[model samples]
Target chain A: MPYVNIKVTREGVTREQKAALIAGVTELLLQVLGKSPALTHVVIEEVELDNWGLGGLSVTAFREQNR
Target chain B: MPYVNIKVTREGVTREQKAALIAGVTELLLQVLGKSPALTHVVIEEVELDNWGLGGLSVTAFREQNR
Candidate 1:
């Protein structure tokens, strides 16, 4: 059972994009590893910019700095 | 950006095994999708069996029933 959990910033992701992500990941696993899409699970988790960090800076803070 | 998180029951998994998992996944992405190893990240989370569920039952309960 291949379970993929994708975490992205909460930046107004549309339902269509989420659907595409699920389908694309499922297809990738199927094509690359011959995994059955029926059993493969793709979960998407949206994290707040305040919570996601990069280079010891929160995404929010980083953006504020860059701006 | 490719960041992968793997969650498994807290069954005393060794450090070497976790390292192998990170390396294997990184290699898979590199081989199949041509993702750069430097950009790929793998995080492992050990979950409590009581918190994980299967078939509407906690993993702990499921095991108790099956035994």
Candidate 2:
């Protein structure tokens, strides 16, 4: 069983985009790893800017400092 | 760096439950693998019943069939 988790900043991603991402990732795994689509699970997670961290700082704070 | 993702069907999971899961997982990794807490990332994903599939049927359909 192959389970894939995709994490991104919670930036207004539409349901259509999420569906496409799931389908695309599933297909890629099937093509590359010969995984069965039935056994593949794809999950997308959108994190709030304040919750996601990078370089010891939250994404929101990092962006503020960088910008 | 460790990235852990936990997914379950979108039942009514309270914020406290999610927080407990994240904390419990992160602590487990740190204790078992000696991973750094700062470098550990835990994400919880709640999936809709219709989106999750099992045995060639969506979870919704599978539940209905079983019930």
Candidate 3:
């Protein structure tokens, strides 16, 4: 079984995008490892920028400083 | 801020598995890194065995008991 958990900063990702991501991951797993799509599981998590951090700074602050 | 995402091949994991994993991970982060449980997010994704692989063999085929 292939389980994939994708974490991304939440920024209004559409349902279609989520579906495409799941499908793409499934197809890629199948092609690369001969896995079955029916047995693949893909989960997407949308995290607030404030909840994500890099180098001890929240993603919110990181983006602000970068800009 | 700490966000934890766990992916596991699904095989009828119990409710205890969900609770224990989330709680344990949360506690670990708190103890090790001083992350607040309130700010921590834990998500678990379960994949089917047929989709998982090792050394180019699907877990389904890899398991002799499955045959």
Candidate 4:
């Protein structure tokens, strides 16, 4: 099975919001990517503040570094 | 940008073979998943014997455990 797992920080999202986002992502993938819902696997890992990064910089540190 | 990175063992594969496999995988994803080659990203990481697992067991350990 080809599974797509997305790991992102959940700083501002609640569980319900996360679920809705996942559902939307799954729907988009199915419609745009043509993947069957049964065969497609989507896993979301919500990382804490200290564990997320972007452009080779941790989110918090990057914000601090920029400030 | 959504990228699909596949990490697998390179125990029995040559460099050329690995490239071929990646190309084949990308093609399959494009045809079967209907993902555009431009937006789709694929990365392959080759793991050594000590760093791989399957069915809750290390590959070598699993083979040994089965014996």
lDDT of each: 0.71, 0.79, 0.68, 0.54
Please provide, for model 2 over A20-55, each residue's C-alpha lDDT reduced to its tens digit, 9 standing for 90 to 100: 666677778778998887798766667899999999
Candidate 2 docks with a DockQ of 0.16
All DockQ scores: 0.14, 0.16, 0.11, 0.06
In model 1, what is the error at residue A31, expressed in angstroms?
0.5
Task: Give the best candidate by DockQ.
Answer: 2
Segments in model 1 whose C-alpha atoms lie over 4 Å from true places: B6-67
What are the per-residue Cα lDDT tens digits for candidate 2 across B1-67?
Answer: 9999788989999999998998998899999999998999998878876555444345665578899
Error of 4 at B22 (Å): 19
Error of 2 at A55 (Å): 1.9
Residue B64 shift from truth in candidate 1, angstroms: 21
- Clash count, one per candidate: 0, 0, 4, 0
Expressed as tens digits, the lDDT of each residue in B1-67 for candidate 1 is 3577755567776787667667766665565445578967878777788887768998789989999
DockQ leaderboard ranking: 2, 1, 3, 4
User: Is model 3 an incorrect, acceptable, medium or high docking prediction?
Assistant: incorrect
TM-scores of all predicted structures:
0.57, 0.57, 0.54, 0.43
What CAPRI-style quality would you assign to candidate 1?
Answer: incorrect
Chain B TM-score of candidate 2 stands at 0.91
**After superposition, which runs of candidate 4 have C-alpha atoms over 4 Å from their true positions?**
B1-67
True contacts kept of each: 0.13, 0.12, 0.17, 0.02
lDDT of 3: 0.68
